[model samples]
Target: MENKYEDYKNEIKEGKRTLNQTRKELGLPPINGGNTEFINREIAFCRKIQERR
Candidate 1:
């Protein structure tokens, strides 16, 4: 079976989904306007995923 993380990453790469959307699909809480720290962390995680490509 394909990894869900890989699947989500590919969906993002293909412009089929945004990070926030993927997070919601993964059951993560949405990052709100005041959640700068969570937003930055998610951004950093995305950067790392991109680096792996």
Candidate 2:
């Protein structure tokens, strides 16, 4: 049987999902001003994914 964690990981690797989405899935709070680094990284990742499409 496939593990849910591995499935989620694949979704992220394929650019089908974002960290913010995963955060919400896990019931975690969304990123905010206090997490500038996370915001910058996720934004850059999203841009890269968009550029490929």
Q: Which regions of candidate 2 fall more than 4 Å away from where they truly are?
A: 36-53
lDDT of candidate 1? Answer: 0.89
Residues 1-53 of candidate 2: C-alpha lDDT, one tens digit per residue:
88987888889899999867987998866876698887788789999999999
Number of colliding residue pairs in model 1: 0
Best by lDDT: 1
Worst 10 residues of 2 by lDDT: 27-36
Tell me each candidate's TM-score: 0.54, 0.51
Local distance difference test scores for all models: 0.89, 0.85
Q: Mind giving the per-residue lDDT tens digits that candidate 1 earns over 20-39?
A: 89889888877678988987
